[model samples]
Target: MNISTYRQLIPSPVALVTGANKGIGFEISRILAESGIFVWMAGRDSARIKEATASLKKAGLPVDAISLDVTDPQSVESAAQHVQTVSGALDILVNNAGIVNERRLNKAGEPEVIPPSQIELNTLRQTYETNVFGVFTVTKAFLSLLRKSPAGRIVNMSSGLGSLTQRSDPNWAYSVVNALAYCSSKTAVNGITVAFAKELKDTPIKVNAADPGYCATDLNGHSGPRTPTQGAEIAVRLATLPEDGPTCGYFDENGPVPW
Candidate 1:
């Protein structure tokens, strides 16, 4: 049977993951699909998302691809409409689409970190466009459908770099790797997560942020020691949290991360 037929056959929970064509987003989609939740692997590139969903379908996982560009309001709305039309409601929404603009090529053509002072205003705007505004746009569009579910969950992909507490420490291991645009965007994501969680606390919906520690993804030139699958674990956990799970909180694999 085709993907649409497969989707109809499974009455399981549904999940939508943005930027799911590769890396940590792909892993989150894989894990969720493996666990019996029908997943919508969303991305801006149709070909990439198609390939991603096909890989899982080959393994008998319930998944399909959707064209979604988080930074575009029209694209986000269209994606939500498609999900509502196909699945009726959304059980989980993972805001995993983001970008890092704190790096540039050096004289030797090697990637070099751009310091906070040297970063341009356009770079910051571009980072926030996808990392912050995109989250708000997508969440607002799909929230009505999420509310339709008996239990809804929202997982915002944050980074440990976003932690002001860690950034404040002079002895922090990554203290030297400061990218103002990327780091501050994640901090804004954390703030957005808390705001949404607070607004929906009385309801069945739960919103939380996941700090998928530095993983070898395209966002960071694949320099991290951790693998994408390893980083995805925390997001999967937060996405599938129980009814009693904590909302409006930030967490990594180890435990709660200080605000």
Candidate 2:
């Protein structure tokens, strides 16, 4: 089914999307707003947030700017409180905020690539700070508001490189694309997704990880084949799942991806 069809399943739900100033997060925010949902486009940069909000507003989307740095506890708390004060509750959250690598890639048309054995410990820590810990911190802060919603959904933006199963396959296309910091961080995201899903099994909340499938975004030096909007499809799907939908799973646009 297309995005328009999926939008019909979810209408007027309030959502918060981190890293929404650009790339897949921005596209996801746009899609959500276009679906009649009230979107909080959260980002760390005030200038980028303003520009993004203006661009979306110009396109007639219902979105508001929010300053949020997922790695900062105080920022996460403040953003959650703001959402609560304004919307009363949150129906959806897209944990799309993340980092690729600590070492900047200077080579044109190439992404940050480094061997696992040679990876720096500090780099790994930095990657996990945003990709893993940030998810936990933000989700915990928003649990109260999420619980109040009739149907609550949490979508963790993961990646195909995180798949241990796929990584082990020699024929896998991304097998040679190993980068310890970013890849392992997403693996932790998958584990985190299941942990929350299990804890909230009996509750109204559902948690799932999404693989955007190498979208051509700043995250990967714009080398990925898919468009940002296409990359957001799986995330949007999980974000708007029905009450009876599956949780504690990894998925892409087509269907479930191997863990």
Candidate 3:
């Protein structure tokens, strides 16, 4: 924390977090910026992205709103190109954009038949398109910039519901919270994180999957246990890992979660 050490580090280290217009992503942007990082608030909606950046700016945070639609290849490439020109290197990448459709009802305790059979295929696909595929596209687009950094960090925003160990165990807390599309998509995100981590095993990047736990956000109708502030803690921690930090792992705020 000394002046010399701080000066040796990258001034205003750049961070890109997708789906940051609101909820957990927004909180992550705020927290990172507050910690002296230049945050790139990425989202699909133009106005929301501006609003997110404006709100953070009002708080005296250094944040830039960027249009990033994870599922759209053209949009991802364009955004990546812009970031390359401006920052030249991406120090941290938080893939926090995710979606769920099992809202408006107490489906958390519902039977398996209800969530899978009752929900439409289109709904399932739409959820995956946002939660899973979006993360892949965004990560792929920014991997090079991240590699250029001395201490690169990639925090894949995953969930506890994605844990197969929890799902298989009948006594586990997340076992009853059944939603095929949503949970499975997170599982895919975890797998993708592992794959990328393996590829960059010898590099300086510290890639890990972080579960924000249950947060009160629009995705779940704001009925979750924690607030967005509480949820952003782990995402920021994983994003700021040192050169010797662990990689290809899954963790919440307190510690690692069961995979």
Candidate 4:
């Protein structure tokens, strides 16, 4: 709940956060750094990673700037090597790098959908390439390091729109903006989290999908209901879970979200 409590809970653990240059990822990195972990601020742009790490450092938080493009295998491999060089293992892997290439403000007044006829296949493919495939690439690249920790945590940044329960409900709040590409990409993330958790059921690795709620970030044109700091709570919590914390689960800021 507080920085002091987080420090008491975890001391000097190594954590890698993707897309840490801004938004919820930035806030998550800040909070984790405040908790005494060496937060690796990872991003595609080398300058951005440096800026983010520097900003946190300026704020008196321990952070390291690391270049990582989740979509690029070479970049992910290089980042993994960086983690290995700093520490023998990685304790936390926050898959926060994601993209949503669709209509942000639906112009249909009420319920809106990307016109089926006009929906660009490239857009959907690109979203999947990042939101879905990129996560797998980064996690797999770092899982070896995570395995060395006593309690390894992998937190996938997802959204409520990923929930099949909500998607199926005709009256759901998110039903208005049916951006299939973005929504389905998140769903794929949730699936990946579950599959990873199941595969590691007997190990110390804990994998879970986290919904940040509607956070006001560049991804959403800052039109969300919550702040990035508030949006990052669940992600940070999942990434720092103790041995007894939930695994193979879907959670939001408040509690478990219906799958």
Q: Please provide, for model 2 over 122-207, each residue's C-alpha lDDT reduced to its tens digit, 9 standing for 90 to 100.
A: 88888989999999999999999999887888999999988999988999999887788888889999999999999999997999
lDDT of 4 at 252: 94
Count of backbone clashes for each model? 0, 0, 0, 0
Q: In angstroms, give how far residue 131 of model 4 lies from its true place.
A: 0.3
Any runs in candidate 3 off by more than 4 Å, and if so which?
A: 1-9, 103-114
lDDT agreement with native, every candidate: 0.90, 0.89, 0.87, 0.87
lDDT of 4 at 127: 92
Give all TM-scores, in the order shown.
0.94, 0.93, 0.92, 0.93
lDDT of 4 by residue, 79-122 (tens): 89988988889988999999877653366564335664567999
Model 3: worst 10 consecutive residues (lDDT sum): 1-10
With candidate 2 superimposed using the best TM-score fit, by how many Å does residue 161's alpha carbon deviate from the native?
1.0
Better by lDDT, candidate 2 or 1: 1
Error of 4 at 8 (Å): 6.4
Q: lDDT (0-100) at residue 171 of candidate 1?
A: 90
RMSD of each: 4.4, 2.3, 3.1, 2.5
lDDT-best of 1 and 4: 1
